[model samples]
Target: MTSSITDVAGIEVGHFTDARRPTGCTVVLARGSAVAGVDVRGAAPGTRETDLLAPQNVVERVHAVLLSGGSAWGLDAAGGVMRWLEEQGIGIDVGPARIPIVPAAVLFDLPLGDQRVRPDAAAGYAACQAASRSAPAEGCIGAGAGAVVGKIFGFHRAMKGGIGTASVTAGGVTVGALIACNALGDVVDPDTGRVIAGARTEDGLHLLDSRRALLRGDAPRPMLAGSNTTIGVIATDAVLTKVQASRLATVGHDGLARSINPVHTLSDGDALFALATGASGRTPGMMTLAAMAAEACALAVVRAVRAARGVRIGELHLPAAGEI
Candidate 1:
């Protein structure tokens, strides 16, 4: 409903958080009849109900979509979403009971915050029940609360990253993007082509130069596991099948390329999802709309970085992009 992604209709977003623990989840819901699809391009994406995204899957309606913090462990939050939907009498019917089908995804945030912190079923249910007709909140909330980027070398050289969103309208169809900006690369200003935030040297006077560092024979090789990942969802009002929705998700990654440098790395669990609210049956031009969606997603990622607040990790001040 917001102008950001005004082309997508009848899509609602809700967020649940534990500020003390610095972790949470965001839920996106299609209040009415909608077609949804997903695309996972990363080598290490954590997701649920992926089978439902296949064209062959007979189930057409997804009661809720969940994005949460807690790495793979956070997947349990979907149980809460299921419980909420079940209470609302939604989902597939079997005999006298209805089972809720909530597709969910997660980003690795456990190492960034209180290691003991996690998102649970209660949080998921709260997010689903809180879905609203307003713009989604950006930065340091939901699954993005503990997200970070530009840590190709190590956490000492990382920068804070979070959630961002944008929307566009073309040919009367609307596409909106919501992104968790966690990556293994620097965030650049797409408009000016300047590094706004990224890894820094121990002295903090120079950039880490990740590519150069990697090529250096003298540089110590850092473990490439569990650094960061960017996950996103693109919602539209276009009436498309699950197959088309999957393609749109892939197309949406162009937005990530425009905003983040050295994206989709082995350490990055980048994933994108595309959904259709099925509010508009008119077929809009695909290529043009895809391009616009990418641009909007890029901008949304930048906004997420800018919106983050500083956090003290060890002895260093991990400043958020906009905080500086």
Candidate 2:
């Protein structure tokens, strides 16, 4: 009943928040090595070891999944996760040595805070050291620390984005999601169909409603490609094959679409990872698990924005959902 990703039996969450800047990493550790799958929907993505997650791949499980800030450079964090897992004698026994399988994704948080600073190997190692079965701290922490959304209008009108988690259970099966909301569009409440956090008007006094703006012939601000993304992980305790796990990840994106406006755009590197611990030993229907996974993911996306606090670095300040 933690209402977090840790609600899954074999999942452990950890984070490393850098004091020097608003950038860091989050690690989801399945020390027992859970069956993993991935779906990358965005045109721009920074990831590592995702190809191995394909159903036809040889590796069926991953020791950890890393979500990080610092864009492409953040992929370095996965190396640290590998080192830590190896230290714990975790990973696939390859006869001579055990090589840990760690899949990772990164979002762009460079425009906020200090762009010069980014997560590295040490940061990833520190996150592993902090891993635990407890519900993790959310909002303006870890990879979500420097996250900002509503970039369609530009960062000046964007709101603070952060980490959030939620879980759902049905028929003795449990599904959970950990979302780091950092999209190039606005976040909406699927239940209410209201814009909760996103771009602001010219005066920065109201929501610009990016979708509407685009419909009205307002072009998004020009920016470099691969500058925004929403990355996350979905965990479930249901027994599943590699294909099912991959399907779960794909269905999980439906949650993001329900909650985020104009998602999977060329500018957003949205990626989701699905990890099945199979601790429950129950093989539920695909439809049931899919529904639970999407629900959990949408809930987590909303929570990420709501729990976030306004961030002020230098003269620029990005407000949180509640503030607006």
**Which has the greatest TM-score?**
2
Q: After superposition, how far is residue 30 of candidate 1 from its true place, in Å?
A: 1.2
| Cα lDDT computed for each candidate against the true fold | 0.77, 0.93
Best by lDDT: 2
Give the Å error, residue 239, model 1: 1.2
* lDDT tens readout by residue for model 1, 139-209: 88888888877776667777787887888777877888888887888888888767767777776655665
Which digits, one per residue and each the tens of the lDDT, describe model 2 over residues 51-96?
A: 9999998999999999999999999999999999999999999999
TM agreement with the true structure for every prediction: 0.91, 0.98
Candidate 1, TM-score vs. the true structure?
A: 0.91
In model 1, pairs of residues that clash are 4-167, 5-167, 7-174, 8-174
Extract clashing residue pairs from model 2: none
